[model samples]
Target: MKWITHLEGGPKRVNHAAVIVGHKIYTFGGYCTGENSREYTSMDVHVLNTITFRWMKHPISDLNYYENDDILPFKRYGHTAVVYKDKVYIWGGRNDRSSCSNLFCFNTTWHCWTATKTSGDIPLARDGHTAVVWKNYMYIFGGFEEESDSFTNAVFSLNLETMRWTYIQTTGKIHAYIID
Candidate 1:
């Protein structure tokens, strides 16, 4: 395993999601425990410059539209994120309050978030799903829905160039190859 030098101001708990671009690590939406209280959602965005290993608060901006307003991925955990071209895409995750199936993208050049729309075969809302960029397509697989808390093995792909979705079937357990 490669050793990743610890970055500062990151959530200490496991399962929180994040994405990295260039040298800056951007973390938005995570769950953390409050002082002698229950777990709570976090909207704080943290930016860390990998080269200098410095951390700072990121400013929010309107760059994307969903439901006629600027859309930001809410505080979530177990979400999946990927970077394509110059944008970072974030997908479904769970939180103390709810689970999400929304998708949002961050434009590195513009430094803002934009919501993506798909026309057909949208995957159900889930958390812990894996999103990976294969060539020009974004492949998503396996996540648990909040209502069921049950893990899934569904595999789907999105053509980023065309913005379309294609569902793919697997022969065996999805976790088989995913696990060692």
Candidate 2:
């Protein structure tokens, strides 16, 4: 494969999650260093059209911006995101203070965010994890546990159809590593 340089209009970020859907790549939640030498976590959603090689920020509604609005996700970094069907599922990221266990979904077709309600054995909130989708399941594997102040080797899965989480027991020895 060859690497090609493209236009540079997108936001400069680190530890963000990027998922490809159709011909575009969608990036969410990461921190960027500001001019004052402070790190600011972002909640903006940016999209890159592969063919056009252009970047556009998708305006997402702010939390509690309207009456009876759904809870929006916080600005975070080191999150994991995966696409299941037309929606991009985001989970497990941390801000300056702490990590999160919430799941947020972005409908690619509608361009809207939905705070997903989950059930069953949900894993502890974490950051720097990896997530992938396979056969209607989103598998989350290994991240830093803020409460324990250590990295974890745990594995969990969420069923897309049922929205239920289940801890998966493995047999082999798998080392845990941070994904960002």
Candidate maximizing lDDT: 2
Worst 10 residues of 2 by lDDT: 34-43
TM-score, every prediction: 0.78, 0.86
Off by over 4 Å in 1: 1-8, 11-13, 35-42, 61-70, 147-149, 172-180
RMSD of 1: 4.3
In order, what lDDT does every prediction score?
Answer: 0.71, 0.84
- Model 1 TM-score is 0.78
Clashes of each: 0, 0
Would you list the clashing residue pairs of candidate 1?
none
RMSD of each: 4.3, 3.8
Which segments of model 2 are wrong by more than 4 Å?
35-42, 61-69, 175-180
> CA shift at 30, candidate 1, in angstroms?
2.1
| Deviation from native of the Cα of residue 52 in model 2, angstroms | 1.2
What is candidate 2's local distance difference test score? 0.84
> Could you give candidate 1's per-residue lDDT for residues 100-167 as a string of tens digits?
77678878788776678775677888887888998999899988866666887789998888778888
